[model samples]
Each structure stands twice: as C-alpha cells, then as structure tokens.
Target: MKKALALVIAVLMVLSIVACASPASSNTASNSDSGTPANNAPAAATSSDSENITLHFTWWGGDARNAATYEAINAYMAKHPNITIIGEPVSWDSYYEKMLTQLSGGTAADIIQADYKWASDIVLQGMPFLNMKDGPIDYSAWAEMPAEYAGNKDYVMGLATGINVKALWYNKEFFEKFNLTPSDDWSWKTILEAGEAVNKADPNSHLLWANSDNLNAFMQSYILQLTGKHMIDTENYKITCSVEELTEYFNYVKALFDTGTLPPIEDLVVYEGLAYASQVPEWLNGQWGMCMTYASNTLQVLNDSTFEIGTMLYPVMEGATDTGISMMPTQLLCVNKASPYQKEALDFVEWFLKDEEAITISGLQRGIPANTEAAKLLEQNGVTNAIINESIAVAAKHAGSAEGPFDTNAELNAAALDYIYQVAYGVLTPEKAASQTIDAMNAILATLK
Candidate 1:
C-alpha cells in the first residue's frame, strides 16, 4: 500500500509541473501573436480588451464658461466614441478651497484648471501633477507669455488656455458727460487728474470703483512700476520692496483718497471685502466712471453697463521703470500625476487647446486664445470682438514682466488691503501703514520658506 501511494504522489508532482510549464509557453505564444513583449503582455492585453476610458475635468467659472466647456466636451466625445469626459464646474468663489482639499486627499480630477498664482504652490513645490513636457501637446503656436508660463522649468506643469492683463475700463457716457476722454497717454498723473475732473463735474459720480481686491491689484502694479521689481522676490521668497518703497505706494493711495480721485472709504464700505466691483450699484448704474479690471472682464463690464464702455492701458507712474501691466494666463489646464487615465487626459487637453473646432466653439469666454493659430481661426470665424482685440494690442505693446505667483499671496494680500483701508479711513497714516505692511508681508514670506 505504501509503494502505491508514493507512485501516485510522484505522478501528481509531474502533472503539476506540466500544468505550470504549459501556461508559460502558451502566454509566450499569445504575447508573440499580440505583438507585445513578455514583460508588457498583461498590460497590452488589458488595454486592447478595454479601450474605453473616462476622464474627469474640473474648472471654476460662470454659467457662460460652463456651457461653452460642456459643448466642447460633448463635441469631443462625439468625435471619439471610446472616451467620456466628466466635467465638474463650480463658481470661482468656492473653487480654490475645494480644489486644495481635493488635492490633499488625492481625489482631484484627472484634469485640473489652475490659476497662474497657484503654480508655485501646486506645481513647482513637488506637487504630484504630471510633467506635461513629455506629453504630445503642441506649444509652437502659443504666444511668449503663455508658453513661458506653461513651461517655466524643466517640466511643463500647465497649459495656458488664454492670456490676460490688468487693464482699466471706463464708461464712455460718464467720460463724455464730464468732457473727458479716456486718456491715450495712460499715466498716473493723467488718471488722477481725469478722476478729479470727473468727480468735480458730478459729486454723486465717483471717478473709479474699487474694492479691496481692486486696490490690491493697483498697488501691486504701482509698486512694480515704481521699483521695477515684483511685489515679492520669487527667487529668494522675500518681499521685493523696502519699507520706504511701500510707504511711497501707501502715500500715493492715500493721496488718491485725499484728493478725491477715488471714492471715500465710507462710500465703498459696502463692497469693501469683495474681489470684484461688478455687483456694486455704482458700477452697474454707471455712477462709477471707471474701474481697474482684467482685460477678459471688459465684455462683462460692458454688458452690465447701460452705456457704451471703453478700455485703457494700465497707467504708468511718472519716471516709471516698468509698464506695471502684468500680463498673465487667465486659464491653465493640467493633468494629475496619480490619475489612472493620464494618457486620455493629455489627449483631451491637446485637442482642446489645438483643435480648430474646439477653438471655434470656445470663442472668447476665457479671453483671447493663447494659441496663435487658434486666435487667427477665431478671428476668421468672426468670433473676435473689438474690445478683446484692443486689449490684446495694448498688452502686447506695454505689458511688463508677468506677476509672480507670490504676488497674490493671500495672507500678504489681505494684510495690504487691511492697511490700505486703515489709511483710507484715517486709522493709520501712510507711513505707519507702509511699515506695518512690510512687516506683515515679511512674516508671511518667512512662513512660505
């Protein structure tokens, strides 16, 4: 009985060996037939069997942007039946906080829409976003600003969709009523003088509409123009200007308030904390003659006004070393490094940025196209508006260095606004405000390091 059991075990061992050896040979033959190496055979087979893919794309914008993006996505899906794009659209107000949370949790969408200011924190600082330089996206047709912004380093972290610059928008009727035309000279003295004349003509109408955020943008530009340096030294992660330089900026702002070039702080209190002056009744009703706004926002401002609107280049300071007009990317598209569908995400982004059909459908919702060919195609289709073209021309002629990501540092921005308001409301002198602002900004910069 023992001898029979041993013989049976030996036979069973031989059969087990043959079973393993046969599958190995069969897999090798299968790989050869499929034109894949043994090492990649499993992955190749899986890809062939399941070619369908879904990609998640997220962005923050208004209803118009959402609708346009959705149409483009649907069109792409129609052309490529194997791909499905899931869009997560939200308002600009809640976008950053939500996206940051999602990023930390590793749940961000496959494709992400990032702001130019978010690049330092989200891309260059070792964030897990894919390096787009290795991808198939084309950059040859893009303008200098967009191309540089998209690929600032060894890796390309973002693909710019549009280019924008800080610009001034004025209500034409208000200017005409005050016997003032938007100045072609575009100097600080000229704007202030114009504002004084407008306010004098109609005490009820203010020369400019500004919220805290608006003031911050103006201050950044002013400081850059005066000092020929960025608000923050991106290389060293420090405040770029001295306390004396900051004092000069604060004093200039105070002078605007004191000379009635800008509306009284009390008058603007209701809109103090807002980022945009769009909802202010004075702006919508045309009581505010002018506003510092983005080039992309000119159309919306015009639509909101009952009167015709005009655009102006951002004013340069006297003896200014720089233009102070910071041309920046309005929208940037990126792919998550950890996403399972990286290839699909890159494919979609390339198509969206370079395809003629996609550009035609996108129109100017995000501002002027960053791709030179797309811009030409958009113009050929008659989708280019005069205001947008003018804005682009002005930026091309006068814009200086683009603002660094640290220029929009939230903590520093808020502190600067607080000090500015304090100076406006007489709680702090310009000298004190400047001192405080420098200290506060330096503290914030230290934390970043």
Candidate 2:
C-alpha cells in the first residue's frame, strides 16, 4: 500500500516477467487470437455475502473521476459493512511508474486499474493479472464486446471498464475568438494554418496543448496515416517503418513545435508526463485552442472550466494509407496475480462492471461501459457526456486498425517518447533522432520476449 515515487524504479520488472509465453499470435492480437478461455469464470457472489475484508483500489485520474470512484466504492461498502475499500488515487503522470515499483516489489493494489496499453504490455510480458477463468468475474455481460477492446481470452486478462478513443478536442470559444473555423475534416495542414492565425492574433495564446503522451499519439496518428503502419511491428519484433519515414514524422513534430501549432517544448515540458492538458496553465486558462488526446479524459480536463469544448475525429489527409483512429479499452480492472486477496479483488471488479447501481454511480467516468447493459442504462439515465459521445462516434467511424500489446510495450513506448522530447527541444536533428529511435527501439523489442 506504500506509494513509490521513483521514476526509474522498474522498467526492469520485465526482466523477471519476460518468461511468460504470449498466448496471442504475432499478428494484430485481437480476441480471435485469444483461441479460448483457459477456463470459465467462477460463479458470482456479492461482496456482501463474503467474509469481512479490506481491499485497496488504485487508479490515475483527476477530481471528477476520483470523486465518482470513491462514491461508488463507498456505496458498495455501505451495502457490505464488513468490507472496507481504500481508494488510492494518483496523477496519471506518476501512476504507471509507481505501479512499476509496486508490481516489482509485490505490493500492487488488490484491484488495480490499468490503461489498455499497460494491460497489453502486462499480457505481452506475462499474464500477471488474475485471469477471469481463475476468479469469480462474471462474463455473461461482456458477450457483445468487440475483439479489439476485449482482452486476450487466450491469456484471459481482466476485462475493459469501457472503450477509449482519441480525438481532436478543441475549445469552441477559443476558436471563434480567433475567428477560426475548425472543422472535423481539417487535416494536419489546416491545423497548422489555424494555429498560425491564432498565434498571429493573440501572441499570448497557443493553438494546442499536448503533453508528451499527446505528442506521441499525434505523431503515431500522423505516421499511421502516411505509412498505414505503427511505429513498431511488434509481430515482427522490428521497427518496420524505415528511418526515412521516422525522420518525416519527427520533422512534422518539430514543425508543430517551431511554428506555434503546438506549444514550444520548453513551455510544455513542465507537463511532460502529467495526465491532463488542464494541468498546463495556458490550457486551464483557455489560452490554448485544442487538446488532441484521449476523449475519455474530457471531464477531468474540464475541472472548474468556463469554455465550451468541441470534438473532431483525429486528422487524416484526404488520401492516406490508413485512417489510423482506434477504438480501444479505456482501462482494465485487473486483479493483481500476486495479491493474496485476488478473489476479493475480482469480487469488487465484477460489481464495478456489472452491478446496475455501481454503473449508475460511476457512469462514463471511465468511458462508455464495456457492459452492453451498463452502456444502455447510462444512456437511459442521461449520464453520457455529449462531447465524449461525439468523439466516440467519430472515432469509431474512422477506426482503421487494432492495437496489439507488442506495439504498445511500455519499455518501447518510453524509448520513443524520450526521443520525442529531444526532437522538440532541438537537441537532435529529425534524421538523427529517427535513426537512433529505430535502433534503440529494435534493441528493446529484441529483449522484450
């Protein structure tokens, strides 16, 4: 239950877990790759029916999510006075690094919350989460789930809380104030033009607010549109995109920085690993125009805000290699394989995912609920945000690929993001950063499995 603050604590955790054989194939690891559930889920029982126990649940979020979570957990506890649930909420920037420490030290929460990339990375490294078949998680409600957001059934990692899709979210007031007409069809080129106009009109306001994670996503989306491929071919264990392609990507990133399309690296670096763009003063004050990151984060970023927000599908050129938008699991509720209270942990997870009361209290905080019935109930209750639904709809329409755990390996992601800052700060030329990134990534990929 102790929090580890060290950033460098455990990329090395994989050294111990790398022995796990991947249940999915080298191709895009969809549910079809998950051949079968190793075993069926245990019959469900309410936590109220079980013995008195204390469980810890941890996740990264801002005030809105953190608040809703506690309310839901408290409601559950009220029903089952014997069970005490502790909520440990941390900022997104610090969440995973802290988890790396806890996971390595065998002190992770009983019920842990994981980003899809983190879940994918965990499954790719090893089945470190308690598989559904090994726990009392009810599977009946997740039947209509797509192969994309569904965890590897072959490995049977824990299920998604909801779906997450990235989009270009903007401040409607900011755009109008700048006399800009932003449209869903705008391309990267149009974005640059709009940014230039905003910069010219108000020297104090910038066009976009993107932390390192957002920058990485935008770069990937761009390259996917250009190359119809991801940064790394996890299936082949290679950086399949050529060095030249990587250079173009980096150059595009550089241009975004230099031309005021994105805030300068120096200004944005303070928020490098922070979860929300709202953490940036310029963004929080409405001095920035857009945030192109996870739409699931909309509510968190709108904390104490005064402006209207808008959504557009992430930009793609008219004729591109791929649309490159992905609809993925917002986060996974996984029980720690090492936790002694895993049975109890899965107990909370099932209630969180399936219980109508729990879903109502936590409606859309995580994204659209993965449970079909839960989704319908949320809609019926008018709990869905109009802005977030806009993003989910547009993103789903344009989704062009499935994400594999390999493509999002945590270590490989770190390597790529590290070079992104170097490119942004002019510490390395685009060509140099690109080649070094490929070489560095390939070296890490070689060691992953």
lDDT of all predictions:
0.75, 0.74
TM-score computed on alpha carbons, candidate 2: 0.83
Clashes of each: 0, 0
Residue 372 of model 2, lDDT score:
78
Q: Name the runs in model 1 displaced over 4 angstroms.
A: 1-50, 146-151, 273-276
Best by TM-score: 1
For model 2, the local distance difference test gives: 0.74
| C-alpha root-mean-square deviation, candidate 1 | 10.7
lDDT of 1 by residue, 147-255 (tens): 3455455556777788788777787888888888675467877877777777777777778888777788888888888888878886787878888998888888887
TM-score of each: 0.85, 0.83
Return the lDDT, model 1, position 434. Answer: 88
Error of 1 at 264 (Å): 2.4
